[model samples]
Target: MQIAITGTGCYIPSITIPNDDFAANNFLNSDGTPIQHENRLVIEKFKAITGIGERRYVEPHLNTSDIALLAAEKALTDANIDKEELDYIILAHNFGDVSSGQSQSDTIPSLASRVKHLLRIHNPKCIAYDLLFGCPGWVEGVIQACAFIKSGMATKCLVIGAETLSRVTDPHDRDSMIYSDGAGAAVIEAVENGGKILSHATRTFTYEEAYFLFYGTSYRPTAKNTKYIKMYGRKIYEFAITNVPKAMKECLNESGAGIEDVKKIFIHQANEKMDEAIVSRFYGLYDRSMPKDVMPMNIHKMGNSSVATIPTLFDMVRKGNLKNQSIEKEDVVIFASVGAGMNINAVIYKV
Candidate 1:
């Protein structure tokens, strides 16, 4: 039996926040000093580097779990499977359920468990849990599902990647503009015929890169004791370009596929420039120029929604929703991501 992703879905938040929406924000330096440049210049520079002009935000009443359940339901319907038949629910997220206007993250009941409950699956045998592997969480969840299927621990699984980065961002920090909120999900199962997983690779570089992305106090000194999602932008870009390509090359090589066979690459939507650099360097590994349109990007409009990027992009492309992008049967694709925990991972898949 081939382990494959049979169905996919995503929930893009309804609220569209354009870059100009942040024009009034009091941007600050890491040391709490105000940025000398006007907000327009700042936002323009951010857009130039990250390719983000707009992003989506959940409505005031929604939380991470709510959107996750929304995506999960769609995935189930797309997969055309009874909820009771699911053997696992794996939800990958970073800051869990940060309520509107709140700083605390609520994970009392794991997001996966909450999604299962919301899905109303009564089967007690369906194991549910949350995974925190930074932005690569969703891709890693797929890897975990393949493991369970191979080990006879599961047959049908729902893997989800959701995040409310908007809720956890610091208004004073410039990096806040790089974040948004969204969720995506997929149904993974043992199939008689369809897409199949070919190979995967994962790595953690904690010795020195552990703190590249972390939770830290606000850039404004007056903000008391509350921490928000933070990162060293330059550090992450350098880390990604230097390492992410190597991992993708490693995974692709392990799949025994030639470089020309890869149709598309679904890389993490962290930054437009960083992603382009990574892919360029990836092709450089084979001493060939990067193919035209080998990578599809939505970060220009969607911003960085963390773990939600890859799966959501996949769902959109597979359904012919992303303009000029689509996947067909027997096509080879690569999924990769890098984020907090200083973690990186890549998967080789065939549709």
Candidate 2:
């Protein structure tokens, strides 16, 4: 029983925050103290370093569930399936929708449930849940959907990764420049002779680096920068270059595929340079030169939308929205992401 991806969709906000916006604002620390660095040069250096030019921010009234609903509708329409036909809705997001002026998120009802309601899906048998796996949340959702379908527990599943990161991101934190808001979704169904989902692997480093990046509900004036996302960027960069390739290799080995067979690698659009380096290193392990168009990127426009990155990139390429990045039937593809929780995962897919 192979899991087949029937359709895909994405919803990016209209508001594009250019790098200059960060330069124009005077940033403050979590304690309300002014930040030391704020300049056009800083933005320039950021772009040179991360390959991000501008990013998306949701409209004033939209929430995580709102964009997710839009993406789901597009995915369902693409799949040519009714909303009621979905057997499961697996949504991924680190922070729930943050209401205006709120410093934190509230996930009491779960974003997936909210989307289910918005879609008017009344099938009690259809499970709706949220999965938190840092930036790999969307990919994890797909892997779980495949498991459910393979086990006869589900016939069709809707997987979504949506986030309004701008709401929770601290205006003072430099990381705010890199975080954005968006949603991406895919419809996966069990089909005879589909054999679409090839293989996947996951790993978590929770003992020492578990809290490397975290988001909390309230602002603490005295605590160690716990209000917004705080991370050791240098350490994360090292971890991605070191560990991601190994995970990807294992996924490929399990799929019985070689690096040369991969048509495109849809990586989490966190840092353009880091993603390129990771893929480069992964192919290096095989002692084979990487193909020129093996990696497709949108970090320049989308930044790190966490869970939304991979799915949105895939949809963009699949629809020919991205220049020089496209896929064809039976084309081999790979997906990988690493983020908070120090978690990493990789998947092999076929078009």
Candidate 3:
């Protein structure tokens, strides 16, 4: 069975935070001039170098499921399929609807069930669950969906990677300034032809060196803070430069395809430097074996939507004016991601 992505769609909040607005709100002195060089200055430089103009954030009271529903509806409509046709619904989110509550009940029920009910899908044997990896959660979700379809457990699956990082952000912190809210969905089905997921490879390095960034609950003896994102930039950059290209090579080799066979590379939108490093390493290893291509990145615009990055980019490609660009069937599309858990995953598709 060939598992293919039939449709892709994304939803971003209506409000956009422009760079100037961000700087003014977070980095300006009383005289309206930029403050001295520091962490804030670095973040501003990140915005400028990455060319991210603005990012969206949901309303104060909104949740991840709300953004997800909007994107999911668009995806189903684009695929010419109904939500009732879905056999499985997998949600990948680092931040949930109820994150700090003591209720042991799964958060998926409230969000996913509501979505299914709104679409009028009665008792569809829905599996509403959250997959909590870091940025790579979406790629992991895709791999899991393919496995479910291939195992005859499902015919169609709605895989969503949505995040509301802004909900956990510390407004006073510069790192949190880049974080935004968005959702992306894909309607995947078992198809006889077209793009087929051929190979997947995952690798993990766990140690203090591997621990670069994190956003979650922290246990403290007296008081614990569960809502914040922490990052060690240097360590993250080091890990990305070392691990990402190596993982990509492994996936490419396992698929029996050379780097040249890949038409377009879709990497997790971690950072501009990481993207450039991966591309450079691939070309260095292949030495003219790599194809000249463009990789879409949105880290500057949306910071990191955690798991939503890859699927969101896919949705952007589908909806954007890239239709004028020359792309054809059977061209290999490679998906790669590295996340905070020190986890990395890469997969190839014959699209």
Question: Which residue pairs collide in model 1, if any?
Answer: 330-351
Identify the superior model by lDDT, candidate 2 or candidate 3: 2
Q: Global CA lDDT of candidate 3, please? A: 0.73
Which sections of candidate 2 miss by over 4 Å? 28-38, 216-226
Q: What is each predicted model's overall lDDT from 0 to 1? A: 0.95, 0.87, 0.73
Q: What order do candidates take by TM-score, descending? A: 1, 2, 3
Lowest lDDT 10-residue stretch of candidate 2: 217-226
2 versus 3: better TM-score goes to? 2
Greater-TM-score candidate between 1 and 3: 1
Error of 2 at 109 (Å): 1.0
Write down the RMSD of all candidates, one decimal each: 0.6, 2.3, 4.8
Q: Candidate 3: where are CA atoms >4 Å away?
A: 24-44, 98-110, 209-211, 216-226, 289-292, 322-326
TM-score of each: 0.99, 0.94, 0.85
Query: lDDT, candidate 1, residue 137?
Result: 99
- Measured with C-alpha atoms, the lDDT of residue 166 in candidate 1 is 97
Ranking by lDDT: 1, 2, 3
Q: Model 3 residue 59 lDDT?
A: 76
Cα lDDT of model 2 overall?
0.87
